[model samples]
Target: MTEPNTESTTALDHVHRARLYKLASLAFDRPDEELEEALVSGTFADQLLESAAALENDDLEEHARAVVEASPTDAAGVDELYSDWSSLFGFETGGDIRQYQIEYSPGTLVTSGDTLADIAGFYRAFGLSIAEGNRERADHLCIELEFLSHLALQTAYLENEGDETGVAVVTDAQGDFLEDHLGRWIGSFRETVAEEVDVEFYRALGALVDTLVGDDTDRFGAEPKTFEETPPSPLEGLNDGEGDFRCGTCGPTSSGSTPEMPMGDRDGPY
Candidate 1:
């Protein structure tokens, strides 16, 4: 991961916190263009956008728990969370992206039989799979995001006269983890997920991951590649001279928002 340059430490801290909150907000709201922008911005934005886009009700309770438990001071508690996640989600080994295929099977959200515990498990698996691919740069960005979020929350707690020092410690630990471990392999992992995963959520996630990494690097003085610089859009050359355009999928529609294709018509996992 690129080291943050010698900027105003406090300013950087504020930017980091703002970015974290923005990511959290985007995850909840799921706006189309803004979500796309967030994904193209950084690793944190990528993870949050994909996670949010694919989020099901089953995972909300667990996310809430994680938010509460992720304090700056609780190293043991944080380790426990990581351990539980690894056991359930199977950490990546051998650095072979293909290995992840055998570990994570694609599953759907089942609202009927879902419990809060089950939902949390799903998120654990999802997050772990993201970390498996070993893209160091991407992992670093994600770690920073997580650390910033924890710090912001802890700062809030401190302002309220709650324990702040421990929270700060946890934030430091999380930052170290981001810098040392996860940041190393997240980009490659995301790419592998995008290429290998058959699920729509995962594919979109890969896109988001790409976007975020690219955006963050740009912010930090690195010129990262973007999706727009890649292959021609499917919508390219399809636009007519006027504002009105036809739909390639459904044929001959007026100039308005194109309708989504029926889910049943899609070839891959829904």
Candidate 2:
């Protein structure tokens, strides 16, 4: 969502947005060998950095460049990222960071309740539910990013079909989703992750996600709520049983896809 050269109307713009979401989704999730290969071969980093370079955002371009330069070139380097990922996001690491949106969205209480239900309502309205057996909640960072990917794709489709009304509806939903959920907490999340992680890979990711969310906020004029009082403490229950997380999308898959849901031609009440 780095401010596009033009409005998100062109085919190239749609493709760029899609790529941004996909990369962000992978970045926030646990690292694996497939992702390592993509990074080392420059397949993922090159595309992302190239897109950022095209943007007018200099900070984004710089972070993307750093990510490309610091990318692991061998299995050992990838293993280092995996280890860092575990320490940063795992339950056993005594980490204060929580990836679920509800944990961060709350003002004083760091527990899940209505906020989680409302987030699930948004997904269900779009015919999306966590894939069966996917233990991650609807508000998990990776799930939210993947949902944005679907929204971007839907916007692209509407644009292609010249459905201005549909585009506006989806665009409004995007802004609403950001304002209510991701935008509200991503700044704090980015700061926490950057402070907690030791590896450059995650640092770059924090920068990238921060940049994108900032741009999205500006584009949509979505004012993120401020933490007037002290932010809530990290809820121990949020990470209590989050055992050995893996990238559902990029990890070794024995059957179907991840918790990702595709929005083809199905009409939903956006």
Segments in model 1 whose C-alpha atoms lie over 4 Å from true places? 1-148, 155-175, 210-270
lDDT of 1 by residue, 31-75 (tens): 245444433344443444344333222343234234322321234
In candidate 1, position 194 carries an lDDT of 56
Clashes of each: 23, 0
Per-model TM values vs. the true structure: 0.28, 0.77
Q: Give the alpha carbon lDDT tens digit for every residue of 1-270 in model 2.
A: 332222644645655766787887886677876688787787887788777765557888888887777777777877887777777786767656688766655453344577888788879878898888889878889898888878878887888898988877777777788888888888877887788767777788778877987776776667768433245345644543664333333433245554665333223311
Q: Could you give me the TM-score of model 1 versus the true structure? A: 0.28
Q: Which one is best on lDDT?
A: 2
Q: Could you tell me the lDDT of residue 50 within candidate 1? A: 41
